[model samples]
Target: MANSNPNTEALALGRGKRPKLDNETVCMRMSSEIRENLEQIAEQYGCVYGGKPWLAGLLRMIGSGELLVVPAPPAFNVKSAVKDRLKRKHSS
Candidate 1:
């Protein structure tokens, strides 16, 4: 038997239509910490259509000023970050 709901059926069949987007592809490099923070931000605020975070949508939101990208606070220290990572590594 098939799902009565088309959306559900499409999802079940792995046939969900990919949204059309611009042909241009953008890529950049960032530190692991920054990338992880970005992913966290996406998880928190980027799901407009699907339940999961959409990175492209998140970037759009940032570009549109719907989301604000702020620098870390004054007290944020690079040495402290390295130390924290080291602690986690040893703890594991």
Candidate 2:
């Protein structure tokens, strides 16, 4: 006999959906650059949670400490490189 519940039928048919999660509203202002970066990470990782959008999953990873932040090394100075090249040219 077929189950009356649509969810059960879906499960039986191998098309079951993930259970929905209750999400709380978190409001904070972030710069457009930051938002874009997070969106990019989400897209890259295919992040999603409880049928939610990629952003939510990414945020969850960050909030749960699953994602560790590493400090980036200082950027190389192009001006210094140019000066070094000039010194080498002059010293040669």
Candidate 3:
């Protein structure tokens, strides 16, 4: 059965949409402990009760300098060289 709510209907149609203002994507890696802490904090602020209100709150904190962002160190890439060596060995 189709959902009667327009928003739900739109979502059912694969048109689930976010606000126009939200047009960017950021990816970060963090420990599970940190994630749990953030979720707890969000709940305290009443931001975790709904769809990504916690994320919005976190973004706001970051924008206001309440949170700090540190860049991760670069990772080494050696897969291609290893693959080439393996291929040469196999072809012999």
Best by lDDT: 1
Candidate 3 residue lDDT tens string, 1-92: 86567666556666756546755677778776456556655655666545543765776676888776675446744456445645775599
Summarize candidate 1's per-residue lDDT along 24-91 as a digit string, tens digits. 77888988766655565687884444675566778888889998888888999966886686677559
In terms of lDDT, the poorest run of 10 residues in model 3 is 76-85
Question: Candidate order by lDDT, highest to lowest?
Answer: 1, 2, 3
lDDT of 2: 0.68
Report lDDT (Cα) of residue 58, candidate 1.
86
Most accurate candidate by TM-score: 1
Please count the clashing residue pairs in each candidate, in the order shown. Answer: 0, 0, 0
Candidate 2 on 1-32: residue-level lDDT in tens?
86567656556665756666797977878876
Residue 16, candidate 2: alpha-carbon lDDT? 58
Least accurate stretch of 10 residues (summed lDDT) in model 1? Answer: 46-55
Q: Order candidates by TM-score, high to low.
A: 1, 2, 3
* Model 3 misplaced regions, further than 4 Å: 1-19, 49-53, 64-92
